[model samples]
Target: MQWRNSSRNYGLTSILLHWGVALTVVGLFALGLWMRGLNYYSQWYRTAPDIHKSVGLILLAVMVLRLVWRWLSPPPAALPTHTPLVRLASTAGHLTLYAGLFVVMLSGYLISTADGRPISVFGWFEVPALVTGIPRQEDLAGDVHFYAAWALVILAALHALAAFKHHFIDRDDTLRRMFGRAKY
Candidate 1:
């Protein structure tokens, strides 16, 4: 597969990043939910959160890279079979996804660093707490993080359903394009 996007199809890079980000986000969300149930005496109590934070930090970096890649190699235009309402909804949905991702990540960061401590990513590096000091920062950010994460995941599910609708119902290449198998 080609490494750069074309006007008619997604390239290998876009395909990989798309799937990578999707899988990572879903995995992180699951991890977060499971870890929440761990009690103080659980063996995974500390380890689970450490893994979550490290992966979350890495995901933030990957998201930045994904945005830059989108800027560098624009995606193909919407398929002609889509109606004007579909096109507008697609655009709005994409923007909401991006916005939701950032909000969730940012709130996670705030909650992690509310005590003014840096986040250690797999002990390889630390993301310094640069924006602490808000009153009840952790509580407030935790609420935001929880709600935003749910919203992001739900929207992503809807996005996938729409793609399936396009492929199975509309019989279009919309889903195949992300898989790098569309007729460009």
Candidate 2:
């Protein structure tokens, strides 16, 4: 595959980022849920937050790079089979996905630092509290994180369903395009 996207198909970078972020988000979601259920005595209870924060920072960085790459190398045109509304929805959906990534990551950061504590980056360095000493703000950030995460879950489900619809019902190349194997 080419290093950049073409009118026909996605490039290696896009495919890698798309799949990588999808997998990473899934893992993070499971880890977040699992860690939440842990008791104070559990080993991961102490480590999980740090792990989550570190990985989330990495994800935020990757997402930034992905956005840059996207701007540098535009995606293929909407499928011909797509109606005007479909095309609009596709555009809006993608924008929502990008926005959701930012929201989730930002809210996670806010929640971590909401307690007026610096975040240690996996024993490497520290990220000082961006929002400090406001319990109400912390609580609000926590709520945003929770609801935004679930919204992301719903959006992802709809995204997957739409991809499947294009493949199975619409018999289009929407899914295959992302795989960097679009014959059309």
Question: What ranges in model 1 sit over 4 Å off?
Answer: none
Q: Judging by lDDT against the true structure, name the best candidate.
A: 1
lDDT of 1 by residue, 1-184 (tens): 8999988899999899899989999999999999999999999999999999999889889889989999999999898888999999999999999899899999999999999999999999999998889999999999999999999999999999999999999989899999888863
Cα TM-score per model: 0.98, 0.95
Model 2 scores worst on lDDT over the 10 consecutive residues at 130-139
lDDT of 2 by residue, 4-112 (tens): 9999899999999999999998888888878889999998889998898898888998999999999999998888879999999989998998999899988888887
Residue 43 Cα positional deviation in candidate 2, in Å, after optimal superposition: 0.8
**Overall lDDT per candidate, in order of appearance:** 0.94, 0.88
